[model samples]
Target: MATSGPVLLVSQAQQRKSRTYTPSPWGDFFLHHVPCTPSQLLSMKERAKVKEQQVRQIIHETIASSDLLHVFEKFRDESGAIVSGDDASCLLMLHDAAHARTHGEEILDGIVAWSKSRLQSLVVQKNLLEPELAEEVRCALETPRFRRVKRVEARRYIPVYEKKSTRDETILEFAKLDYNISQAIYCDELKELTIMVELHFWMLGVIHDPYCSRIMIVKIFVFISLFDDLMDNYSTTEESNVFTAAMERWDEQMAQQLPAGLKALLVRIFNATNKIEEELKLQGNMHAELIKKMVINSAKFYHAEVKWRDEHFVPTSLEEHLQKSIPTSACMQMANLALVSLGNVTTREDVEWVFTFPKIIRGACIVGRIANDIVSHEREQASSDHVASTVQTCMKQYNVTIKEANEKLRAVIEEAWMDIVQDSLEQERPRALLDIAINVARVADFMYKREDAYTLSFVIKDIIASMYIYSV
Candidate 1:
């Protein structure tokens, strides 16, 4: 039921009043936009594809050569061959070679076993390896690249690629530039987002990896954040009702009575929706109607919250708050937006599964909503104007102290994650789609684990620096 497209900003008076809110230390740097044109996006995509092909070719050639196999064979015959267990470079080669789809018959099964045994011996002996190589060995042992998060794998391999003397300098340079460009685009979108809604783009880029995918994530969250602020702080009961009706109607003619800011926001949302629809159409998807329905449903939920606040009413029980919170959280809408970048890989059936509110998706929404409330409840209560957060509702319903309520909510968050993992195993859906749901919860944990990191940027400065300023 959550909405999509660009979000509308709060009234100018409300914005001025909220200026007392703490701003990020990196505000100045983040605000300076570095525009990335369509051509640049296309070029980066092409470069990434070409680099991937080159890496594949290099792996294929290394596997075909018998030099590494001969070394392994020599060690296999000796009682104590002194094979360097810290040879991650060699281990990586073996891992990829064993998994190669099309390869000349060189018999890699024995080599894989021999290499794995030595690696295990190194682990048993607690042998010291360079930190980078040590982590690589641990990851290879624990989770193969195929099952690992793509961004983590990319970050880990970039350093390995740089260490090789035969590595193509030009490709490495291009990769570095591509990364910087991506960071810049993220910053530009984030700056515009922060003007109305306090949020971060770090986790989105990490999970999505691709440039276009990251952009879509930023767009979706930006709108969600702004809409949340409007419902929570800016709109009155009458204004909220009028706005909701206009959104449900979804026509320019219905927007005439809206305030200036709401009018502008509606126009922006429609523009963004149109743009997304065109892109999806080009990709042979018919998602415009579904997205429109989602936006309208989200507005209806927003109106419900406004009515509750206006009537000075609190939910009678915790379950009541959850029923409303699930749709209002907007996690499902965000998940669908992320999937748009996946193109034909996501089938119509996959989209239907998302809409059905399966356990994995429901668990993610619960985590996102409760985690945010756990950290931000006191701050929201201080305002005395916001709708009842889950933390407060639980305290009132159970007649417990704030500390006790938070402890129970924390337990609920943990249980939700367990449900997500269990459901992921049982479901037959695409792993990529499931990962999107998991990543939403992960991002929520990152944003609110210590405090309301999304609202106060200082808490997440180090994370932002590592993701943007420093390269792997």
Candidate 2:
């Protein structure tokens, strides 16, 4: 569990008592989540498998079909086919460009560029569309489907599609059924799905990739979450530094000097990390060195932040802060580790590409780093031992209002999304690998979009219920 997001801080024992963490809003409710009955579980799993086969068939058909990716190559207002023709032609071009762009095909980039430009103008055209249609056009222009997480987009599109004049009853019916079954599978995985669990699901489910890695990822997350709290709210800097050394040494004996809780945590982490390595080896991945290095490095980053807190250091600039914080997100490590569970679909080259922090990995990390900071900064700043967060540092460096600093961070997230899109078009990386990296960012954005839904579990209690408690 490599800690990510803003590091929590606590003062020394001499100055003041160590801080304590806020309890989970759900409290002991987590202890009582009942698994679905066996019959219900079988039904949902069977339905999901059927849908999986249908999706595979569709993908085969798509790859085997004739290429229409270039059908709108010359479509433009001046070409006398898009704008000069009837409104149907304009609509057709818009749909075609949108379709290709969403699929990550760069073959129609020129057409997409022109189509988007014209669509932006047409969004304001009063006579061409009804008021409702105009609003849809604007919304589509502002937040295209490619920019959304698939699960989020599905839940959102239900009402919109229900209102459409030509909506297919069969498609809508299947969508509702599919949503419920997927939610069941998600909920069945754990008591409640936190943001990292959501991230683990999406990283694997986006392309229907192997899920053998999820067990490792989620276990690591729980361990790291506990360790992060202990380091940030309870332990002295001396204890954290020793625990970090113990991590690097990979020895239980090295942690003997620490308190009982920390020693137990270190042992659990060592066991969890080793279990991951062993399980992955059985899957034909022998990257123990890489996996061990990631765990060690994660501890190092956590220790560094603790040092910053103990010294009362405020980063002078936002870049300086990100230089340390982004790595703390562990996006690169998570992406690399996930490749192992993919079995053979991914290559060593893909793992190396991530290790180098290519544009896609860096972009994904930034999205997670900045989005987490945005929601947690205010609560973090309230602490006397506040370690400088992205929001706080931005306000200090740019001398802007809190709202303005937030706006700036949101803009940065948008740019990171662009980088994800741009890298996908390159197609140099494996598509499976690309989805793993891209969806890391998407999960972060979804979790932190409106509030700290991850931390303030109450905010997403309904969503959790929708996935776990109710049937569609």
Candidate 3:
């Protein structure tokens, strides 16, 4: 019998080597299949144009290390809460390759190593039949040289947008306003849910013409929904987690559309989530109202999508998924639902923007949790339940098995936030809208520094930077 370990690594490596020149399986999978309108594509270009300018100005300005320190050191009324939110968002957002460049080069190397390790783990778990493909993924993920060039491009991309339109000025101002609004929003647990509401409408706002491309717009919506579900609970409990709600809302529609094999896969996923929910007895009390509203609206969105597909309606440039979900009767005054419903409206109504604010804040919360989990995933497994015992579980997880991966992630988060801040400042960019994201990265760095789990290397700083993204 052949040894599985070496055989797996060699196969994965070869695949990675072969696939480097072509589009990645994951990339191709996402690009063609994901739904979005033409208007959404135009919106993405607009956002990207604006984002590019913000990034460029940051690169050109003589930003002092002291300015960076000052921003990090500043205190707010809800300093603790702000810090927590900031750390989580940064972790979630900057887990990409491009932003990993601000730190020294080793962090990129570490990502490659981690990808390789993931391939190895997949083999051990029997999740990979084609080890060569796994190796290919590892190779693609390992491209430090590529990442470096991308970073330069990203930096250059921001400045070119400075000349675009007056909309840039207005957006920059709005971002600054979000700083105060975000802090206020986060202070009240009820108000925090507003984050989701705004993001959804942001999706809606991109509907320019029927023929406009809406890939970026739709991507944001889908991402927010998936992320919201992931953050709420990975389990499939009926008590009402994000996953359970979405499943309930979209199950039939998705099921009818899917082929038999895919439908079976969906059923299994649903069953698994439900089982997890049962095992955990996951409390819906914390996010009950928010879950209810999200479920109702999500169901509505799915309902409309199904109708359009069933009728074979002329593909409207903008889908009317938004039209079906609104005017929920769920009372927000009830504390349980109030907190949940705080930031979850589906309209672009004046009050709706506040509702979506919490998604970003909540995203930060979840990202922080994810980072902590990265530190502790292994140890938690040995426990009777795979529950985390410490706040710094991610740090702990990094220390024991994948120290370098954790370091790389942290560095990326830090650099990403700094770059965003620089862009916001230099281009009059919308820094405030991304407050939660920036704060998440900042607090993560602070936490890591205090924990001293790993060496304070340049690579670690880079991961932390990549965590910051501009929502402006």
Q: What's model 1's lDDT at 298?
A: 69
As for model 2, its CA RMSD to the true structure in angstroms is: 6.7
lDDT string, candidate 1, 51-91, tens digits: 76776776687689746534434433355433444466676
The TM-score measured for candidate 3 stands at 0.24
Question: Ranking under TM-score, best-scoring first?
Answer: 2, 1, 3
Q: Candidate 2: lDDT over CA atoms?
A: 0.66
- Per-residue lDDT tens digits of candidate 2, residues 410-459? 87776677677777778687877888787777666666767766666666
Q: In candidate 3, where is summed lDDT lowest over 10 consecutive residues?
A: 326-335
Against the unseen true structure, what C-alpha lDDT does each candidate score? Answer: 0.66, 0.66, 0.33
Candidate 3 deviation (Cα RMSD): 24.2
lDDT of 3 at 218: 31
TM-score: which candidate is best?
A: 2
Q: Which ranges in model 3 have alpha carbons more than 4 Å from their true place?
A: 1-370, 383-401, 426-431, 443-472
The true-versus-predicted C-alpha distance at residue 301 of model 2, in Å, is 1.6
Per-residue lDDT tens digits for candidate 3, residues 1-472, read 4799787556533322111121111222212221334565445556655655675675566464336443322322353322222231122222243333333544443433444444345445554434443333443333322222222223233333344453356444433333223222222221222223222222212121222222223322333244322222232221123333446564544555443543564455555444433432343323322333444444344333333322333222111211221111111111112222222222223123324423333333333333444554454444332222222233344443356545655553444443534433443222323332334333333333333222222323332222112222
Model 1 TM-score? 0.65
Residue pairs that clash (backbone atoms under 3 angstroms), model 2: none
